[model samples]
Target: MEERARTEEEEMTLEEAFVRLDGMVERLETRGIPLEESFQIYKEGMELLKKCNDKIDTVEKKMLQVNKSGEYSEF
Candidate 1:
């Protein structure tokens, strides 16, 4: 059988992840929600934080490993 299309949640991109993280921070700062809801928001924020940080770390690591003496390197 053919594979089904994945929804936005399943296909979240790095940009979308950052957007969510920003919104989470805004809500936490606003302090309009109840304590229980804030806790849930905090949990999700942490997960997003990890994901964003992981993505950045991965990119940085890849850049560091790139040989500066390779053909693409300047003289």
Candidate 2:
């Protein structure tokens, strides 16, 4: 199941994942959601969070590569 989630996440841009995560947050915050459904949303949110972090990491690595001095600098 995680493998499938990762594959799907790979196809999703970070902005899209952020939008999905925001929706999940709104759903979780609303009244009347069942406990089970809330748990599912939480799980999906975590997965999206991980994907966003992975995407950010990839971008940071590329930024570092572009810098010839091999030192981290504020973008």
Candidate 3:
């Protein structure tokens, strides 16, 4: 069950994660948000950030592999 949940999160594209993070930031910046809600948003934003970082790391590794092979191919 946990693995499935992780797979679902990983299925979100990096771009989509960025958009969600941006929206979370906007919500966090808005005035009069309840403290509990703000905390929830912060937690979700952190998760999205982790997802973005994971995607970036994967891409970087792929690029490195391609470079090592001295070949250019679509990622």
Report the poorest 10 consecutive residues by lDDT, candidate 3: 60-69
Query: What are the TM-scores, per candidate, against the unseen true structure?
Result: 0.63, 0.74, 0.74
Order of the predicted models by TM-score, top scorer first: 2, 3, 1
Q: Which residue pairs clash in candidate 3?
A: none
Alpha-carbon RMSD of each model: 5.9, 4.1, 4.1
What is candidate 2's local distance difference test score?
Answer: 0.85
Specify the poorest-scoring 10-residue window by lDDT in model 1. Answer: 1-10
Query: How many clashing pairs in candidate 2?
Result: 0
The reply for model 1, stretches above 4 Å from the true place, is: 1-11, 64-75
Pitting candidate 2 against candidate 3, the one with the higher lDDT is 2
* Candidate 2: segments with Cα more than 4 A from true spot: 1-6, 65-75
lDDT string for model 3 (1-75, tens) is: 978867867898888788888899999999999999999999978987988898898787677335567877655
Error of 2 at 5 (Å): 5.7
The residue pairs in collision within model 2 are: none
lDDT of 3: 0.84
Per-residue CA lDDT of model 1 for 1-75, tens digit only, reads 113322443357788888888898899888568899889999878866776787777766666343656534221
Relative to the true structure, how large is the alpha-carbon lDDT of every model? 0.70, 0.85, 0.84
